[model samples]
Target: MTISCNPKLIACHDCDLLQSLPDGEQRRGKACCARCGAVLHRYSRDSIDRSLALALTGLVLFLVSNLLPFLALNAQGRIQDSSLLSSSLILWQEGNTFLGMLVFATTFLFPLSSLLAILYLLLPLRLGQRPRFSIHVFRYLQSTEPWGMLEIFMLATLVAVVKLGDIATVIAGPAMYAFALLILVLAALSASLDPQLIWRRLDPRCNH
Candidate 1:
């Protein structure tokens, strides 16, 4: 763990109140706005190595989720399977252009972008080297985190499977499991990630 020797002052995003951190060693915690009780930010000392591992794993699962079959629908003894990209293409071909684009963006593109961005930002930091555009990439992650809807997509998939089971046999494909695991990995990545550690590595003077 990196040692922080001095206290720092930060402005609350909620109330715009400036507050000082306790004088001494820094530790894992959540800072809240004194006036509004809104959460200002969080601090933690989680390992960088673990985050890198999760990023790599999520990337692999993402690939498998896209390349392999996601689901197989068997109706009247006819089996039809679809991969992630193919599903989007099918939707586009069927003239659901807007929804196709939405699914592609939220489920595939945004999620992949997030994983790649994580690797890009964390890989160099893990090697004890400073990465270019570190601040921009980190800010991008913060801004775009809500855009990636892996969990929402997974829930929709489960609902579709359950509903389709009454009329047709829905075989859970390899990609389904991979995507599910990818969701879990990404969630773990988000939780295990230490904002304090990332900012500390990115900038020595950074306090939040």
Candidate 2:
């Protein structure tokens, strides 16, 4: 989504104060809420460039989070470490196929797809080419938004730790910590994205 900075009608996201976009060369593209410091529209000066960097980082972290052991437990000198995939497999083995599929879809599939879709949208746009599947990819990301389920995964992790505490000592692994933070950053970035801005840039005549 793309936006042409309208200097005449800026509204504060927090306080709802209406004002004008700032005047002068220095304030040309800067956006700030009129009554509060809240940002209404924001873009990295080189948005496509930054999005690619973030997408690559997110991809690597995602791989580590899924492939490496997510957590570890030690009891009576016996140790166990399991990855996210391992957990899903365990769930399936325990006669919880439906639940296993739920975990797989929400925790792994949707979030990864969203990140990849964002990359597909931004990378091409950054390179001065139109996004190959801009609208469709954006729609997929939007649909997957509610199903990302990182918070649910964290809650389940906590529950597992508590349940296992009586039988074992748990040690959080690097992958566990990384996945938690990656979920947070990904959620933040997705929330901050304004599709209207991209659409405007993509089509000058579309009213958003």
Report lDDT (Cα) of residue 158, candidate 2: 94
Give the per-residue lDDT of model 2 (tens digit) for 1-208.
2233553455676898877654433333447775677866654444456556777778888988887778889999999988877776888899999988888888888878988888888877776677666877787887778988877888899999999999899988888987887777776575446554566556635443
**Index of the highest-lDDT prediction:** 1
For residues 1-208, write the lDDT of model 1, one tens digit per residue: 2333333666777778877655324655676778888866555454577888999999999999988999999999999998878767878889999988987888888888888988998898887787889889888887888989989888988899999999999998999899999989999888767765677678756533
Look at candidate 2 and give me any clashing residue pairs: 1-197, 1-198, 1-199, 2-197, 2-198, 2-199, 2-200, 2-201
Residue 30 displacement in candidate 1 (angstroms): 3.0
In candidate 1, the residue pairs with backbone N, CA or C atoms under 3 Å apart (3 or more residues apart, or in different chains) clash, namely none
lDDT of 2 at 207: 40
